[model samples]
Target chain A: MRVLCCVKRVPAPGAKINITADGQDVDTAHLGFAMSPHEECAVEEAVQLCERFDGEATVLTLGPPEAEEQLRYAASLGVQKAVLLSTDGSSWDPQRTASAIASAIETLEAADGPFDLILFGNESADSGGYQVGIRAAHALGRPIVNAIKGIEPDLDAGTATAKREIDGGFELYNLPMPAVMGVKEGLNLPRYPTMRGRLASKKIEVSVMQAEADEGGQTRVTLKQPAETVSNTVKLGNGPEAAPAIVDLFEELGLL
Target chain B: MADILVLAETEDGAVVPATLEALTAARQLDGDVHVLLCGDSVDADDAAERLGEYGASTVHVGESDLLNVFGPEAWGQALALAIEEISPDVVLASGTSKGNEVLAMAAARLDLPFVANCTELPSELADDDEVELTRVQWGGSLLEQSQLSAETRIVSIAHHALEAESAGGSAAATETIDMEIDDLYARTQVVGREMAEAGVTLATAPIVFGGGRAVGSAEAFAPLEECASLMGGRVGCSRAVTNNGWRPHRDQVGQTGTRIAPELYVASGISGAIQHWVGAMASKQILAINTDPEANMVVKADYFVEGDLHQVIPAVAEEIKKRKA
Candidate 1:
């Protein structure tokens, strides 16, 4: 089984997100970078699947050159190969991103074999378009589902069982090999990179390929912050003394 | 006027509240609101009546064996065919998990651009070839204004962004359509389900007792659990709690976790980071209990108590118990 995972490098936002002066991008001066939480789980799941199934897992990313850091991070987590679909630090529309990623997958498959399974984050943390995986699945002519939290591959049967979380339970889907999935966070707790793994990650070779695709129809005009509503909190009391006031308020609200 | 079509989501034979919200959004475009209902389990006549009250002028029902079970491709194919037959200027749906998935599938099939989780749409979108729209990003913490250029504009209204108001109109006329669902679409259909114990879940709970990193450890959540149970609610945790392994990720409340809308959310020891704040902002009322008087959660909450949750939660629970006795 050959597994492939796609990841995106996003700003590691703390407390609040600051916008650049041009309003075209997130201000990166004071922020760090990391993959979305969902993508981190996807990378972990891919590595785990390969480890169990006796195969290699390749990590691919469509991002700027700095995204090599993310690819190397995947490497530190036991991913066997790293490929960077280099961009020019501009955000690509979901459609264009999917197209470029599908092209890159095809190029990679031509050299090796087809990936038995491919994974994507449910949606990017920043844009949250929620369509790239679906579009890419369509382009690849493979069945796909989003918001998957659990996966079990039956190598002998050449099938995979996926679990999606709903309000009150789980929805299970079975897909044939060569399927794609848009996995969410909580699929697994990703492992931390060890010191030895960090040194190994630096030695891993990263294949850089240009992301060439036409712009999609949806174009960004600007980014704006929602107006914050400053709350006038009524301080009930302090410590245990506040407990009675809290209960009274709850009673007033009819929660009693 | 823009002719708008809304994809109605139904549950247990009735239209979901979010779909009504979508209908409300559609009416804002100053167009005749048409709806598409797909599912054999849905009571089309009853759903049409409810949707009509929300300003749906027509309800197009598509029922097929393929749609009897949830399949994104089959539903998307039905929606794509409906768009072709109806020739509406714009298509709309609630920004739900399934709603966005099916619409993205339909958009992919039609090779058109789709904008999901839109908070605002231009009134004159039908008259223009390209128009600017505002969409929710970062799970509602930020908004992105974008220009959408497409022959048929497709969008989904962000959940809870607008109120579901009744227009008090007559019932919509129902028309059944031939849903030509491909057998291949069944490959991706839901095969089975493992239902959780039915009760007050985190999403539907009226009261949510939320704990953050300050809760210390997993065992420390016992106080919160007892309080939530006493209040007939559920216990939720912040992303930090889950990340620290003090709680399961399913119990997390944040942009990456569950987006909860409760009558009251008691957030304890939470700093109210942007990611977490967006998810909790929908609560009707918030009471923050943190040691830091200037914590983000405390400042933004409707009520605050400057104290440790360890002492305050137990004290609150004891007060409720004594009152009950």
Candidate 2:
């Protein structure tokens, strides 16, 4: 039951996101890079599945050479294999990203047997286009389900049941093996890399694959940060003393 | 030159607000707006009647047995048929869970690029073929404007992105498209659903009373709940509350959680993070109660009461009781 999980290197943004000077991208000089939150969960889920099912787990990323840091980080958490589809670091449009990933999947599967499940973050932390995973799945001709919170594969039955959270309860989706799923955060709490595991990860070799992608139709115009929502706080008094004032405000609101 | 195709979703026998909002967004584009109505026993004429008021030019009624079940496979199959029968330049739907999934399914089947949660689209495509797009990224915290030069571009309009307005008067006519589905359409279907909250959801509540980590424990949420009900609102919590296991994820208000645009949001003990700010920003007014005078929620709120929530909350509740009595 081999599983493949995809992750992206994104800046760990602070409360306020700063746009580039030219407004073409996010300003990341002071920020640390981490895997997209959802993909972090995906990598964790893939490793857990391997622990439970007794199989190999591979973590892949399509980014610059520095992205190997994210790959190695996943390796620290028990991933047996790490593949870096190294790119030039500039943001690749969703189409090119999907094409390169699909081609890479085909190449890797040709050497080893196909994975039972392929995972992706529901959407990238930055671009959040919400289509790359589905596009990659389409290119591979596999059924893809996004926004999945829970997944359980029945190896004997060759089916995987996916749980998606909606406004109310969850929805169940059952698909066959060799399927792709877009996972969201909160699916599971990702574990930290242990001291022994961190030491082991440093010695592991990373396989870096060049990403050859054709320029897609979509080109990025300038990226502008939407204006900040301005708010001014009017003191409604303080502590127990503010109770009457709040009640008065509530009365003004007709709540009382 | 091509028509704008809208997948008009229906709930409780009426056009959902999101779909109506999508129709409004469609009006921004060039050419006539043709809506694809995918449902069983749907009143094509009736829907066309209401939607015509909102600017639907032609209603394509897609009736099929496969439409009866809510599955991406079947929904995608039905929509793919509509897309093939009428090749529209741009496709739009509401950015609800169902809307995004079904369009993604159809896009996958058609082998096209589908954009999700678009806030703005070009009124007209460029002569060079690149369709301009501005979509919400990281929930509403940021916007990304890009281009999709596909022969056909699929998009889902973000909820509440556009104010829905009636164009006043029905369009010309309705066309019926009967669909033929295969067994593979049943590969994945929704077996059942259980409503998380029977009534008063976080987003729909008139007044949203939220709590944070400072609220202490799950059992301690009782006073907040009582206050919320008294104010005719519902109880919501911050991600910290959810992470701390004091509240369910559904009651969370944050970038990834449900965005609430209520008339008022009364947040207690919440040091608002940017993620939570994005969700609460849409509220008409915000009031924060926190021990720290400079908490993010306090600074961003319209009203602030610096105090301990455990004491302040009960005090506020008791004050209301005394005032009413």
Candidate 3:
């Protein structure tokens, strides 16, 4: 019943993002990085599952050396071990990320045993690709569920019932063991690290895996910032009179 | 000619608006557009006629009793069958929760490149006929343009980002296909659904009045809800408000909750986080009512009213009543 949770480092929510001067990627000079919000939920879910099932939880992340901070944070949340697949600040698209994660999982399985469950946030709050979980499942040839809002494990039958949020409501599914799930927020409120936990997390070892070219060259093009529209301010009457003025404002912005 | 396939999402046997929008985009590719509808014994004639109005030249109907419940694996298998039949150049789906899951699995089964929440379409086809796309970044505050090298491009359109246009002609053609429902896979079933008791869904509400941490307490949200109802709308809340237990999770409007496309979005006491902005940015008009003149939403909004929600919301509601009279 061992579980693995994949986490990513991203710009903190609400951070004002700026494009680099070359227009190739986000400007990181003034940005503050933290664990992706949804990934925090994934880590929390993994920790809770391990606590309930009497197994170990391992946290994984693929980024530069700095990403070790996120892994350490997961360790503070009762994760037994941390694995960092370090890259040279290269953007590994979903496929490459999935391959690296699958490779690491295979290596870990060789040492210990296979993980019973793998958890991930629905998508990175930064890239918002929303493809890694499915790609990883494909690469590993396992059952996968995305944007799952709830899960009830049936340990006797070796199956899990999951509730996935749909457009207006939710859909239910039954999947066998050794499946991957991309969790959405509100699954649980992630716990904050205690003083003792923070002190112990600093002693945990982080193993860094070297990236292979084939598994690191998936990103085809770098991202560039979009053209910015100038901000304008207007004030109309508070009630019905404001409706026409709002329409006029939209028309002025060419959004009408 | 390379053709595109669109998985038209439907509920209660009717095509969703986002599906029509996807078809509208597909028609611009200058290739045959096929629409796939999977449901419980759906009428192919009626479904195909509606799909044809959205520029779907060919409508593939896959019906089975198993479709009474939405199973990703079963839907994935059904879509795999359709893809095997059409071998489309590209597959398009909406970025809704169900659409995202089904398409992700379908793309993986076919070993093709996949992208989600695309805001813009490819300007021109590549030499290999691969289509590039532009998608939002940083929680919709920015846009990123990129190209996929795969022959089969899988993309999901951002909901409400595109307009649904009528196909402007008679029904083109229709075909009925039989799909198998494996009883074994039916092990998982949705016994029932408990609809949210909220009067109006956040996504469809014409006016969304949202509360944030500044609202102070759960009891304070009643006035905001009253104001929303007075405006013929519904109530929404920021993540902070939901985190504080002032509102239900379903009422939270943000990246983690529901992305809304309303006619008017009123931010009451909300400071406007990027995640929150992503959900409400597509609203037709934004009105930020915050005491802080420098609130982030004030900058992005079409109009800013500098006042406390406690004072402003009541006044606005009263004015609406008076104006109507």
Candidate 2 CAPRI level = medium
TM-scores of the candidates in the order shown: 0.98, 0.91, 0.89
Residues B1-325, model 1: lDDT tens digits: 6789999876556678999899888888878789999877687778878889999999998878898778778888889999998989999999998889989999988989999999966786755769898998888878999899998999888888889999998889999997888888888888999998889889889999999989999999998999898989989998888878888888889898998989899999999997788878989999999999888889899999999999999999999999888
lDDT of 1 at A48: 93
Measured by TM-score, the strongest candidate is 1
lDDT (Cα, tens digit) per residue for candidate 3, span A1-256: 7889999988774625677776676778777788777788889888898899888999999899999999999998899899998898767777677777888888988998988889988888888888788777767877777877787787788888887776567777678878888888877778889887798689999988975526321243556655553468676545443444444443455433
Q: How far out, in Å, is residue A108 in model 1? A: 1.1
- Point out the higher-scoring one by DockQ: 2 or 3: 2
- TM-score of candidate 3 to 2 decimals: 0.89
Candidate 1 lDDT over A1-256, as tens digits, reads 8999999999988778889999998888998899988999999999999989899999999999999999999999999899999999888998899999999999999999899999999988999999999999898888899999999999889999999998888999999889999999999888899888898899999999999888888999999999986899989889988999999988988888
| Weakest 10 consecutive residues of candidate 3 chain B by summed lDDT | B123-132
After superposition, the stretches of candidate 3 with alpha carbons farther than 4 Å from their true spots are: A13-15, A213-220, A227-231, A236-256, B39-41, B63-68, B176-192, B229-232, B314-325
Per-residue C-alpha lDDT of model 2 across residues B119-238, encoded as one tens digit per residue: 876765412256678888767778888777787778888988888998897553898898886666576666555456577778788888899888889999998898887777889988
The residue pairs that clash in candidate 1, if any, are none
| Off by more than 4 A, model 1 | none
Interface RMSD of each: 0.9, 2.3, 4.9
What DockQ, on C-alphas, does every prediction get?
Answer: 0.83, 0.51, 0.35
